[model samples]
Target: MEIHPLHPTFGAEITGVDIGRPIDDDTFARIRQAFEEHALLLFRDQDLDDEKQVAFSERFGPLEKTFSQNPAGGTLFARQSNLDIKTGETIPIEDARMVYQRANMLWHTDSSFKRVPSLCSLLSARIVPPEGGNTDFADMRAAYDALPDATRQRLEGLAAEHSIAHSRAQVDPNLLSDYQKSIEAPPVKQLMVRANPVTGRKALFIGAHCSHVVGWPEEEGKRFVRHLMETAITPDICYSHQWREGDIVVWDNRSVLHKATPYDSKKYKRLMQRTTVAGDQPTVMQ
Candidate 1:
């Protein structure tokens, strides 16, 4: 198999490997190594069904079950589609379902509010619209490396509050239903810097899920978080992926932040399934 760099800093495209079939141990090892070094791996043109997607994702670790708020709850898959699940028809722009999807456009890591955050996420493209609907990823490792010495030193040992409701509230305060709010993950404290166990690389962990710094004044904390976000998304630190049918994208949630872009769901259909690999252990604070 040949691996090609998709971006100067972070992503790689693996060609000549079909994930639908079983892979040997040595091949899987190389893939894992590439993942650690690149932070994102894309395998194109592999027709992955739910079963195949689960099998490939399991190679990384045990999968995370969808939460109560997800339409695919009780399963390992988190469904993303514009069609109404029961009717299989295009949902109107004003529908609550569409509003629910708007929250995804915000930059954030998957499952960051959990006590044990996600290790990585794998998303498979089942159907693609004619235009738009791309996924953009920011390399946190690069962001951390670019910080001034004083800023980097100050970031160490810092902790921030993270919550599911906090991120969703960015799009609309009432987007989450009252019952859904009851089921939301309570705010959890997480270090601003995380060290990758396998690579020993440090990355900034701040994102939309971050409500504020644990001990700082509330307004100051928001400004700090916003500044870090703005700095991290500078052009050289990001890579945007345009989905094609049968593309399986795996991104390390520990090392990158991602957001979805707009698509004309009113005119066309789009479907994507995601499987998250649970972080067996909590992040190591720097």
Candidate 2:
């Protein structure tokens, strides 16, 4: 298989291999190396079933269980679609369920609120809308490299708090019931800068889920978080992926941030399935 870089900063497209079957160790090693170097890998025009998708995802590591809020919760798949499975009809964009997904439009690294954030996420595009519905990825590693020396020095030893509660509040406050709020996704003290274990390259870890920096006033923490997010997602550091049926994109959650673009949900059908690989282990003080 040949892997071609999509851009200088991030993304690569892999061709000439079928992911449906098991790959040899050498090929798998190369693929893993490519992933470490590229952060995002797009494989086009592959007909992968649920079984095959799960099997392929296992190559990276154990798959994460779907979030309880998703329809496919408890399973490996997280379904992203506008159509209701039981009703077999399109959900109105204003519907409560649809509104819950609005949070996804904001840039985030998946599962960052959890004590153990995700290592990577594999997304398969089963259906593509004619207009919009693009996914954009930003290379946090590149973003970190561009920061001024003083800014980088300041963030080196800091830890930021990340929470799903804060993200849910932005999209639909009502969706987070009292029980959900009480579940205590306690603040995690993650370093502002993360170093990729495999590559040893550093990346900025701040995103929408990051509500504040530990040991700082709320407003100041928020401003710092916002500044890092803005710096990481500048147009020069981003690449937007336009969806196509049978396209699969695998992104490193630890080294990149991703967001969804607006689409005509009323006019066309769009469905995407995602499987996330669990992180190696937590890096926080108890």
Candidate 3:
């Protein structure tokens, strides 16, 4: 397989290997290495169904079972679509499901609220809208490298709090029920900076789910988190992907932030399936 860089610093497109089918050990090893070097990898014109996608995703690690907040619930897949799963009819715009989807437009890393967080996420586009629903990714490693010496030093030895409820509340105050908030996904702490085990590249771990720093005063910590997000998401470090059918994008949750762009859900159809690879260990012991 040949790997071609898609962005100046962080993304690449891999060709000459079909992920729909099983790959040999050597090929999979190279793919894993590419994923570590480049925070994002894109594969185009590939056919993959749920079974195939799950199989390929497990090759990296054990998958995270989706939480009850999503329609898919206890399943391995986190479904992103405008249609109702069972009937396949368009969901009304006022529905809570659509409102939940709006939170995704905010820049965040996947599964950061979980105790184990996530190693990576694989999203496959089964159906694409005619226009407008792109995914934007920011290179946190590059962003960390660009930070001033003092900011980098400040980030070290600090941990931040993360929660799914924290991010969803930004869209609507009652977006998540008490059970969903306290049971399915509760607040957890993660290191403010993370270093890749393979490459030893450190990246800032702040995102929407990151509510505040563990020990700082609430408002102060929130302001600091916002500042870090603004610093990391500048245009130069960002790459936007306009997806096509049969396209699968794999991104590292530890060193990257991604958000969904707006699409006209009322006029078109879109379905994307995501499988998350569970992180092997926590960033810091709670």
Maximum-lDDT candidate = 3
TM-score of each: 0.95, 0.96, 0.99
Candidates sorted by lDDT, best first: 3, 1, 2
Model 3 pairs in collision: none
* lDDT value for model 2: 0.86
The TM-score between candidate 2 and the true structure equals 0.96
> Tens digits of per-residue lDDT for model 3 on 69-182?
776879999999998999999998889888888999999999999988899999999999989999999999999999999999999899999999999999998989999899
Residue-level lDDT tens digits of model 2 in 1-286: 9999998898999998788888898998988999999999999999988889999999999999976676566789887889886786999988766877788899998888878888999999988998899999999999999999999999888889887777888787787666655574555657778898878999999777788888899899999898777665788889999998989999999889999999989999988989999987875664
lDDT of 1: 0.88
- Per-prediction backbone clash count: 0, 0, 0
lDDT of 3 at 120: 98
Candidate order, TM-score descending? 3, 2, 1
> How much lDDT does each candidate structure score?
0.88, 0.86, 0.93
User: What would the per-residue lDDT of candidate 1 be over residues 21-107, giving only the tens digit for each residue?
Assistant: 999999999999999999999999998899999999999999998766665666898888887778888878877667767878989
TM-score: model 3 vs. ground truth = 0.99
